[model samples]
Target: MNQYQRTHETMAAYERLHLAAAEERGGETLAAAWASVVRQWRVVLAAAGVGLVVALVFLAVTPPQYSARALVLIDPKNDFSVRATRAPTDSNTDSANIESQVEILRSDRIVRKVIEAENLVDHPAFRPGVLSQVLSTLKFWDRETPAKTELARMEATTRALQKQVTAKRLGLTYVVELTATMPDPVEAARVVNAYAHAYMDGQLQFREELASRTSKALQERTEELKKQAQNAERAVEELKFSGSLQGENSASARVALKNLESTAQTYRVIHDKFLERYAETLQQQYFTVPDAQIVSAGFPPLNKSYPKTLIVLATALFLSAALGSLLALLLDRRFGGARLKRDHFA
Candidate 1:
């Protein structure tokens, strides 16, 4: 029995005691976790019940909204009766054109037309309440006098209408969807249909105006060319008559006659060209190719578009349960630690 052998025996006994203490503490930890969960069960259920009530109240108070949608198909190739001579660069050009049409659908001019046509100025959705108007006037008093001019009312109505309507281009296609949401299903459908009609009418008017202007220009040029041709023909006839009366077929007279005839021919050729263009422009005026075709007109929706009660209730229930569980665990850690220390002292 040396000093080294005695030290080794002491270390082995200490390791055995430490291992037994760790095993006992692990069992206590599992039991404490189970006790915390059991104590919080009532809190979790109460929180869930409160959440359900709040969701129900919200569903009761909110008004139902109906959505209507109109679909328009844009064919760039057949956009106008007079197609451009230059071809598109690639397929991407078609996408760009479709996007441009989408912007046109959302433009203020088109929306204003729809609003005026539908008489939406007096509609509750398009007109703000008295309180909101007062607030807006107060907020912008320093910018200018708050007089409600026709322009101001129009601007306000346009802004409100813009909020209720939306236009989206279908992905990688020539289709555009114009959607409107309102409290009345009939009004929603009417708004969307108005948008479609207004857009098509605008396109028609634009093309007709363009063709009218072109026709006017061609008509003026044709008149001028006719006069020039008549003058040239008169000059040739006068020269021929003078040569014949003098009985002289001189080289100078022949040259002059040839020059006059050539000028007249040239003028006639130009006049014919102008006449052809004028005729084409007139035909274009009668041409009735639609810029955008209505694939589907808007219809009144059968059901409300918003306030999904079940989804709202389920989300509230899940959030409340998570919050309640977290709070209970925190309280248990705070109080349980204090009790354990007091017991240890005792």
Candidate 2:
């Protein structure tokens, strides 16, 4: 045979001979590889099984959480041509303003007020009736230690409870979304609804204050303008009676009368302008009240928003399997073990 044919024959015969003894573990190298894999299988199965059991225990013991949400709208109720023209510039409806409001809704001032009003720290993880309150008092002992150490500790607890709440912009329609999560669905819904009401009440109080101030200033200025107009008329009448009026000619009475007439006209015009401005001020005072409205209210959620047991269990199982496979591979390599070796089945 030629050199090429001879080389091909030798390779083929070597492969067939290797395949024939593959199942017998006739070679020392193959036997060692099999031994290593068998030794490491025990560690791999044990680690994976332990991990899965721990995961199942944790999933079973974890508490379920529920979430509720509310929505409110903020808009202007006043009618003004100037307001319409400059609404984008003057209004808080812009993206930056919306973001600022979102931040404000999540601010400690609002959040702290909500916590205090709802008495959330002392609330139970069940229904929201009187029985729930009694139950909560019983369980409070188990949950938190009595006698807070410092103001920081109290504040920290308040903030932690507050963190379970969230506020964000729903869209560009001056609407805000409020959400609260708790172990109790009813309590979550009630707290979220209470937060919405509190925010609306705050807005109403602010608007009322602004309206009162505007009304007071307008009243004072209106009175002042009326008095000024009356004074100007009286001065004109007095000048006429005293014969001090002067006209375009050499007569002093004509000239004095003309001057008085001019003064009265100026005063009347100013008085009218003030009256118009006062009316406009009254209209502007209604802006905040009408611009903002509550579009939605929160209710008890039918499902929990977090503490997903199935997902948690699946993740744990996957992670455990992956880690076990990696560890098994490493230990097998170190111990001279292999699985499904080349030509083993053949």
Candidate 3:
């Protein structure tokens, strides 16, 4: 080999050696860091154990709540695009209300109907508990009549029910999700179903009332028009007969006869129109359309909706360990090294 080639080979060997030493040094640093992490595991474990105990206590003490859901379809049928608009939203009828279907479901009127039908006012679930009794006594120390007390109880129960029950339209769909949360899952299901049924009943009742009122009004108007038409026809016949008796074939007589005939014709046309409308009202009343229907009825939930135990415990443990590691690091900075281990034992 030439002098220059030998020198280059020697330099390359020294570079390889330098790279090897650097890699070994980096590996040692990584091992030391891992060991340090392993040493702090005791802190993490201690914190995690404390967190687990706290979670366990919370699970034991906290009362579980049950939730039941019911799906009510706002427009169950294709009635909206059809004559249902006239049946329900009939502006001509004053008895029918123009309230939105979803709003009607959530209204206090419908809710109160359910409460009354189910006799919730007398139920212990609706009645005031110990806390409520204490507050009521504190506020109203004076004696109150049983009647007044009953009224107050009813009002309180309604307000409480309003809070427990919720109705919301699901996105752009016609479905409305009605949910009720109560201590008793069965009661929750019953109440939710009750509310749905109440809303539907109200809609049916409203349609009936509207149809009845409209039909009655139309009948009255039609009878009056019929009488007027008959009277007009009778007058025209009398006029023609009187003209025939007098044998008056003059231009004025013909003109008078023509006017009488026109009046009778006008009355007859109006009577026919009213008669048609009355028939339609009767038909609509018989085949009344419902504003909403219970698409999916609520049932008692199998699992408690509140206080998810497993998730809570896992989250608690993870957070505690993370915080513990941070605290360990701080101690390593504060009292650092062998002293931190000594302090941990102490």
Candidate 4:
């Protein structure tokens, strides 16, 4: 055979051989992918098993939290808010001033008061036994740090408790919800009730403050009016007694007398009217706490709200299995040379 023909035939044979080898490699790649998945099956199972175990342990060790809630109807009549001062309604009720009250309910001042009411700092949950309480009680010993340091520490504990308690607004209604959570059911109930009581007391205090301020302002105004009236009366009397009327022209004298008399009369009328209005305003100033009835009380929760065992365990198991499957697929891909570079030099 000619050299060129032989060379052409050899090239064709090499091309056919290459194609067959490539086909064989592709088949092996698929088999290896399956093998990788099989190899990693044990790992996937182990991960899932470990995840399940951890979830079970968490469920066993963690203690459950108890919750209690109370509902309060905001009184619109008692709610004389600064916003409504420009155009006040005929009657104020609990419902009218709830927005301000809601802010108060969640305030630190209320939280601190509630903590004080329960004496929560000395409780077992806070300090863990009588010894902890005794150390807390030794106030004078820690003179360098200040007694407030201990109080601050106690405050931290109370702050944590406060965070757990919440006051929420009812749906388009004039009701406020006060809720607290504690290990003991009774403590939760007491704390919630105290919050309601404190809110009512605060309302009464607000009214008293308004009344006292208005009274003081009115009294000062009344005194000023009285002084002005006296001055006017003195001027009239002086003009008459001095006999300036006789010395001046007859028409001028008459005019002066009439002017003084008119000035005195105006002042007298103004003083009388102010006195009457001030008296009426004073009579209307009175602060009273509204009677709040509890709509619901918090009770001991029968079940714990945390450490969802079944759900956690199931999630962990699922993720572990999925990871194992992915690892298997990656190994199979590598063996199949899914990523390869052609060699031009060869």
By lDDT, the best candidate is 1
Model-by-model lDDT, in order?
Answer: 0.84, 0.70, 0.80, 0.69
Candidate 1 residue lDDT tens string, 1-346: 9999889988888888888888878878767766885787787778788888888888889887889999999987774445533465567887888899899888999989997898877678777879987887787544654564667778888888888889999888889999999989998999999989999998888888988887898899999999999999999899877754354557767877888899999999999988987888889899867668899999999988877777888998998877777766777788888999999999
Which is the better candidate, 3 or 4, if ranked by lDDT? Answer: 3
- Using TM-score, give the best candidate's number: 1
What is the per-residue lDDT of model 4 for residues 246-344, given as tens digits with 9 covering 90 to 100? Answer: 754757867877887888788788778768766655654653344344577656556544445567777877887777677667765665454343343
Order of quality (lDDT): 1, 3, 2, 4
In model 3, what is the error at residue 10, expressed in angstroms?
Answer: 35
- TM-score of each model, paired residue for residue: 0.78, 0.67, 0.73, 0.60
Worst 10 residues of 1 by lDDT: 79-88
Question: Total backbone clashes of model 1?
Answer: 0
- Residue 180 alpha-carbon offset, candidate 3, angstroms: 2.0
lDDT of 4 at 210: 67
* Clash-forming residue pairs, model 3: none
> What total of clashing residue pairs does each candidate reach?
0, 17, 0, 13
Off by over 4 Å in 4: 1-49, 72-85, 88-101, 126-146, 168-175, 233-286, 289-303, 307-346
TM-score of 2: 0.67
2 against 3, candidate with superior TM-score = 3
Better of 1 and 2 by lDDT: 1
lDDT, candidate 2, equals 0.70
Query: Distance from true position, residue 121, model 2, in Å?
Result: 5.0
